[model samples]
Target: MKLQLETIIIFVQNINRLKSFYVDLLKLNILEEIPSEWLLLQAGGCNIGLHKMGEHYPNKSEGDFKFDNNTKIVFETDQDIRSIRASLMNEKVPMKEVKTFDNYPYWLCDGEDPEGNVFQIKQRKV
Candidate 1:
């Protein structure tokens, strides 16, 4: 038996801001969007879905859904790590300093979306 992952839904406080980061900054193509409600983006083999928090979820009050600090979404890239880091910095995206793991042969840095959803950008060092 095989299981397939279809979409990853992230509840965010601001839909437009998160969409802009994925579309404008990361350059992920938009598959579909519903203003202030939902957005689907094409990211390689998977689709990333962003839904406005506390709006569409049933039985949820305003400010009920919050970004989880323990959740980290990672995107792997084949591009130059330094170049990607520079681009993110230029966009004023708050990011950690790019670093190499002592146990792994890759360069990685973390950044956040508008509402503080954390994500990591990583590139394997050649």
Candidate 2:
């Protein structure tokens, strides 16, 4: 028997805004959009789903929502760190200075979506 993770759901107040941030800004491919409710995005081999939350939801607020900066979605790759950093910089993506720890390179960036999720970009030595 084999089991694999298929998706990770991130809750949001607005689907359009989330879509724009994930699909347009981050350049993630959209797998499906379910009207005003949800959107499924392609993140490598796995999927990320954004669910729209109602005002009654416990976490919903009148203004913009804030996410825990400590929570990060890491995208791991063997791609060149310098090249990736250059490309992201050219696109004006807000990223932290690259740092090395335990012989690995990593950079952090805010996803800039409506929900304010953090993304950790990691480049493993090849």
TM-score, one value per model: 0.46, 0.43
lDDT of 2 by residue, 27-99 (tens): 9998877788978899997788787875555653324434443234556556665666667767766455667
Pairs of colliding residues, candidate 1? none
Model 2 C-alpha lDDT versus the unseen true structure:
0.62
Model 1: per-residue lDDT, tens digit, 1-126? 122344566767788989789999999998877899878899888778786765344542324233453345667777776787788878987777889856666687767787877676767788
| Model 2, runs deviating above 4 Å | 59-126
Clashing pairs in 2: none
Q: Report the backbone clash tally of model 2.
A: 0
TM-score of 1: 0.46
How many residue pairs clash (N, CA or C atoms closer than 3 angstroms) in each of the candidate models, in the order given? Answer: 0, 0
